[model samples]
Target: MSDGVKVIAVNRKARHDYAVDETYECGIELLGTEVKSFRDGKISFPDSWAEVINGEVWLRSLRIAENPFSSIFNHDPDRRKKLLLHRDEIKRIARKVDEKGYTLIPLSFYFKKGRVKVELGLCKGKKAYDKRADIRERDIQREVSREFRAKLH
Candidate 1:
């Protein structure tokens, strides 16, 4: 089977604010109208995250705008969604999250093989100095690329 991946939304701030140590791709429980909203690219996840609750993982703060055609049947825009993960995987994630400074964050959302999938990141919050250093490194990389291009021409 061909693996077709179509990205729906990405939380760009998550990477800048947290240092991701590992990532997991899992399916999310979504409503029909929510899926339609995704197809329309009407999704926004601000300050969104995931947490292991009662042996299950749930995504919180994800906002999928209601589909115009769904009227009364449209899903709630701010409802938390369940993330489908294996029992063993959830247990492992819970253990890791219990460690100090580690937390779960949603990195991106996409459609894989016609089904919605979530990319969850196991991350540690970055300090202010860390963010500054990242910006410095990015600037240096940009300059280096510019100089390399100039030399080639």
Candidate 2:
């Protein structure tokens, strides 16, 4: 977190579906109009994920909505944006991805010093029982907090 950073969108489903192990801050290659759209909060990462291809990380299924004012030079809303990451970082992440059940997921997007950045998470999909356990743990925590608040009042 810094002075000029502003969060644009977050993929809540990522947290619900995956057990995030590590995070990476990476840059996104965006068109001029796409930046405008992002600033206006017209972006989504519903079915989106990242992949390492040819030693580069590519963001797939990130939808930046079309800017209405930018008529002809608008970028495609469904383009696979390229991610800017260091060579060693990409290789490390790629190796982790090659593991049996690991994948890359975009957790959130934001602006850092006027440049858009994506928070990429190294995650593994959760089993049904894992998800249920998470839900149960959350419920127990909520009840404990509620009881503490009641005693304080």
Candidate 3:
């Protein structure tokens, strides 16, 4: 099968704030109207997260706009959606979270093979110094690239 995945939205802030250790690609369960609205690029969430509860993974805080054409049959804007993942994988992640300093965050949202998929990251909160150091390193790399480009001219 072709891997023609179309990315829908990304939570860039999550990467800057957390150090990701592992990632999982999951299929999301959505209502018909919700999916319609999502296709129009009307979905976003600032503090979204995933949690393993009762042996299942659930996505919380995701906001999908109501399709204007749906009338009174629209789905809730902020609803908990189930994520499809292997049982063993869920257990493994749960163990890691219970150990402390680990969190489950939605890294990105996309469509794969005409279906909605989410990239979940197992992350640890980064310290203030860590973020500052990352900024310094990025600046250095950018400056070096610019100097080389000028010299080549």
- Best-performing candidate as measured by TM-score: 2
The model with the greatest lDDT is: 2
Worst 10 residues of 3 by lDDT: 1-10
Positional deviation of residue 142's Cα in model 3 after best superposition, in angstroms: 0.4
Using lDDT as the yardstick, the better of models 2 and 3 is 2
TM-score of 2: 0.97
Models 1 onward score TM values of 0.95, 0.97, 0.95
Q: Quote model 1's TM-score.
A: 0.95
lDDT of 1 by residue, 1-153 (tens): 135988888889999999999999999999999999989999888698999999999999888999989879988899999999999999999999986658889999998989999999999999999999999999999999999999999
Whole-model lDDT per candidate:
0.92, 0.94, 0.91
Residue 93 Cα positional deviation in candidate 1, in Å, after optimal superposition = 0.6
Give the runs in model 2 whose Cα sits over 4 Å from its true position.
none
Compared with the true structure, what per-residue lDDT tens digits does model 3 show for residues 1-153? 247888889999999999999999989999999889878879986799999899999999989988999998999998899999999999999999988768999999888988888999999999999999999999999999999999999
